[model samples]
Target: MSIISMGTHLQLLIHPSRSPIPHRGSLLQVADHGVRGHRHVRAHIMAARKAIEGVSDELNAVASQNMDFAPARRRVRTAFLPVQQQLNHVLFKMAVPEIQMEERYEKSSRGVEIFWKSWRPGQGEPMKAALFFCHGYGDTCTFFFEGIAKIIAAAGYGVFAMDYPCFGLSEGLHGYIHSFDEMVDHVIEQYARIRGMEEVRGLPHFLLGQSMGGAVALKVNLKQPREWDGVVLVAPMCKIAEDVTPPALVLKALAIISNILPEAKLFPQKDLAELAFRIPQKRKMTAFNAISYSDQMRLRTAVELIKATHDIESQLEKVSSPLLILHGAADKVTDPQVSRFLYDKACSKDKTLKLYEESYHSILEGEPDDRILEVINDIILWLDSHSTLK
Candidate 1:
C-alpha cells in the first residue's frame, strides 16, 4: 500500500494487509445514497444548469426525473450505466463544501473567481507539503472538496483546489471549457509555482484529478512528464466510455457550432427539487446543497474537454510521471475499462491501478463514505510508502 513519492504528491486507499474488511450489513455500504447517487447527480446537478435555462421546467423535471429511465427491454440502471463502472470494487460518494472558486486566478487567468485554502500539518513538522487538485466539467472544486478535503487535510496534506475556469463563481465567459492540453499546461505551470512556495517546496507535491479532473491529470502528466513522485487519475477519462458519439462527429459539430453559438449548452435543466424530494436516503437530497448550487452555476459545455480527451491517445506514451489510476468498475460516467487501458498503455514504470466495484462515475459521492475515503487513503498510503519527505 506504500505509494511512490518523487514529483508531486500521491494519495490512495490501498488494500489492507491480509484479509479485507467485510461490507455486509454496513449502513454506509447499502445506504440509499450509494445506489441513488447518480440519479441524484443527474437530477440535482442537472437542475441548476444555466445552459438549460430556456428549456421548460417541465422538460427539465422530466429529464431530471427520468435520467435513469431506460427502455422497457432494459432498466435505466442496466441499460445506460456502463457495466465497467457499475460492477467495480467499490465507489463512494465524494462531498466536501458548498463553496465556489473565485478571484485573482480568474481575473488573470480565465476570468473565473478562484480561491484556494491550505491546511498544514501539526506544529513541529516541516511545512514542505502541498496537494493541489483540479476539478472536472460542470463542477466546482467545492463539489468534490465537500467530501474528500477533510480526510486529506486531516492526513497532514495541505490540499489546494481551484474552481475550473468557467465553473463556480470564477469570473469568465459562461461556456468556456479548456482543452486537455491547455488545462494540464496550466496545471504544470502552477505546480512549478507551487513547488516554489516555501511551505510546499521541499515536500512531495501530488497532483490529482477525479473524473474529468483525472483526464486533466493524465494529459498534464503526459505533456510535462514531471519527475514528481506520482500522478493519480480517479476514473480518468483517457479514452472515454465507448458509448459517446464518435470524435469525428463531435468535433465536426463543435467546429460548426463554436463559431455561431459557443454559449450553447450541452445539458438542459431538470427537476432536482422533485428528485431530491424522492431520495430515500435521509430524504431530500442533501437538503439542496452542492447539487442545487452546482445546478445553478454550470453551463451545458464540456465538448472541449471531450475533444481534448480524444487527442490524448497519441500523447499518453510521453508521460513519464509515476501514476496511480483509481477507477470504479460501476461508474455510470467514465468507463473503468478505460482506466485499465491506460494502466496498461501509459509509459510510466512506477504505475499502479486500483479498481472498485459498485462505484459510480462520481465515486466520491455515493451514500457510503468509505468508498471515497478508502480510495483517498490508498493514495496517501501509497505516497507515504514511497516518499522520503520526513
Candidate 2:
C-alpha cells in the first residue's frame, strides 16, 4: 500500500493481487489525479518518518532500562497516524460506494470521549441486522476494520466499532489497562447506546471479535448471555499460547509488581506482526498501523489479559449464543487448540468452526485475498442463517 497526494487530497494505491475484490481491475486508485497531491503526501511521509526516527534512540534507552516512556511513544504515534492510516492495506485504495460511513466521538457514561465509527447500507437499502465489533488489544477499529465494516454494511448489515479507552484515538494513557472488567463495562455502555438507535433498535445483533477482542466478546456474552443473537470469533485469544506466555515465576513476579506499578511498561515484547500475518507482503504492511500499541505490555495490562483468559476458560461451558469460530490452524500467537476447546465447550446449540490449514493469526487481514474473502463469506453466511432466529 502506498499513499500519493493528489492535489489537495491523498490517494492510496494497492497492488493488483492484494486487492480485496479480485474482479476489480488491478491498481486500486483512491485519489483524484494531481501532481501536487503527490508532493504533499511525499512530504508528509518524510516528516513523519523523521519524527519517528528522532524518538528511536530515546525509546531504546527507556526499553533497555524497562522504564515507562509511554507519553513520548504516544506523541510519535499521534504524529504518524494520519500518514499511517492512509497506508493501511485493507483501506488504502479501497472503495465501498454502496456503504455510508460515519465517525464520531461520544462522551461515555464515565465521562471519557469514546471514538467510534459506523457503517450502514446506503439510503433506501433495508437493514438486515447489526454487528458490533470488539477490536483486539493494540488495535484501533479505524484502520483495517474500516474496509471490513464497509464490506459487511454493503451486505446490508449495520456495523459498529469503537476504540477502547486509551487505545487508538480514544482518551487515556496509551496501552495502559487499569482494570479489564472496567474496560468491558465501558464497551457495554457505549454499545448499548448504538444498539438503541432507532435504525437498529429491533434488529438482531451479533458480536464479532478478533484476538483479544474475542475475549471481550465472550465476556460481553457472559455478562448478558441473552443480549446477543450470535458471535463471530476470528483467532480468539481464549488462552495465550504457552510459548508466548512468560515463565511461571516471571508471571508471578509481574503480577506482584502490577499492584504497585500498574501502568509500567515492564512486560516483554514480541514481534506480533510476524506471528500473526502469514503473507510476507501483508506482514510488511502492518508497519503502517501508526496508532497501534507496539510497545512492551504494561504491567497491569499483561496481568489483566492473563486473568481475563483464565476467567473465560473456566466459563466456556456457559457460552450459549450461536457461535461461528474461524481460526488459522497454524496460528502461533493464540492457540488454535484453544479455539477448538472453545468450540467444544460452548453450549450453543448452533455452533460452527472453520480452520484454515496454513494461515496465521490474522486470517482476515493477513491471508491471501481469496482466503480473506472466504472467511468473510463464511461469516456472512452464518449471520444470514441466524438473523431470522428470534
Candidate 3:
C-alpha cells in the first residue's frame, strides 16, 4: 500500500505500491582503507542523523497538538512518510529480480489469522532448501527481515516468516504475548502446514531466529526433534540480560500485578531502536517504522518472555538440531554470554558461534554496513555449506 501525501513543507514522494521490502542498506558508501576515509563516512552518518532528529522532533510536535487520537496518529504517520519512503526506495533498489515474494494470511490453530510472507527463487527456479524464521519480541517479521530474507533467498534457499500473534498485522492486543507456549504452538501449527506443502516438502528445512526468536527456534526443535536440520540464532535470548530485567522484588510485584491486570502496560520499556541500532542515522530512522511496536512492554508479555527464557535455559541440553549462533559482543538487550551458554550446554554435535565485536542488539540491521554485511555473509556461507546434499 502507498502512503497518500499531504500538502506541507515535507513532501513524501509518491511511489508504486510497496510490499515486503528491506531497509535502506545501499545508501551507505563503503569507506576506503584509511583513517580519513572512515572519519568522512562517520561524518556523513552523523549529519544525516541530525537531520533525521530534526524531522522527528517536528513530527512529534505535530502529534502533540491536542488533536483526537486517531487524527493525531494519522498526522504523525503522514508526516513520517518521507523518511519511510526514502528507506523503501533503498530496499527497492536492492531488489533481486530472481527472488519472488508472496504475502498471505494463514488462520492459526487459535483461529487468529497470522500474516505470512515468503521469498524464493522466481518461477521455474529449483529450491534446494527452506529457512523458516521466528522474529524477536516487539518486532515483526514483515519489516526488518525484508532485506535479510532476500539475501538468504538469493543464496538459493526459500525463506518463510510469520509475524507472531499480536505483533505486526496479526490480531491481538498490541504488544501482548499472553502465553509463550501458545506462541510456540502458533508457530508450530502454521509451520507444519508449510512443511507439508508439496512445494516445500523434501527440501532440507532449517529454523532461523533473532533475539527471543532464538528461544522459539530452540523450543520448536525440542518439540519436534527430527523436523529441522539446523537452527541459526542471532543474539538469541536464552536468558534475559541482567540489566534489562526488573529487580527480583520488582518482578514479583509485576507478577502479582500481571495476574490482576494482565494488559497493564507499565514496564519501563527502553526505546529499543536507540538501544538496538548502533548506527546513528539508522537508529533515528527507526522512528519512522510505522508498524513496529514502540509502546511500553505490557506486564503479561514481559512476564512470559522472562519465563520463556528461563525454560529455554533449562532445556538447552535437549537441543538436537545443528546450531549456528551469532551475537554482538556488546549486546545489552540479550547477553552475548547466554549465546555462549547455548553453545556450551547444547547436545548438538555441530554448533557454531560468531561474535561481532562492539556491535549492538540488531546485528542484522543496526550494525555498520561492513559489519552487518559480514554477519549476513557468514550466515549465507554457513547455510550454503549446510544445504549441500549429503
Q: Compare the candidates by TM-score and give the number of the best one.
A: 2
Q: Model 1: per-residue lDDT, tens digit, 1-390?
A: 111111222111111010111111211111123221231111122222222232345533432331211122022212222321322222213333232222234233533234444445555544334667766554555433534655565566666776544444343433255344655665666556657877677777777777567767676666655546678777665674454434465456655654443343333223222211111342222222222122221122445544666677567777677788887676544556777888878787888988886665545544245665687788778766655544
Which stretch of 10 consecutive residues in model 1 shows the poorest summed lDDT? 14-23
Candidates, ranked, TM-score:
2, 3, 1
lDDT: the better of candidates 1 and 2? 2
Q: Against the true structure, what is every candidate's RMSD?
A: 15.1, 13.6, 14.4
Report the C-alpha lDDT of model 3 over 60-159, residue by residue, as the tens digit: 5553332212234335545655655557323323656677899887787667878788999878888889999998766667655877888778878899
- Winner by lDDT: 2
Backbone clashes in model 2, listed as residue pairs = 5-37, 5-38, 6-37, 7-37
Regions of model 1 farther than 4 Å from truth: 1-113, 178-180, 247-250, 266-300
Expressed as tens digits, the lDDT of each residue in 278-329 for candidate 2 is 7777776655455566554556777787778778888999999999999889
For all predicted structures, in order, the TM-scores are 0.65, 0.78, 0.77
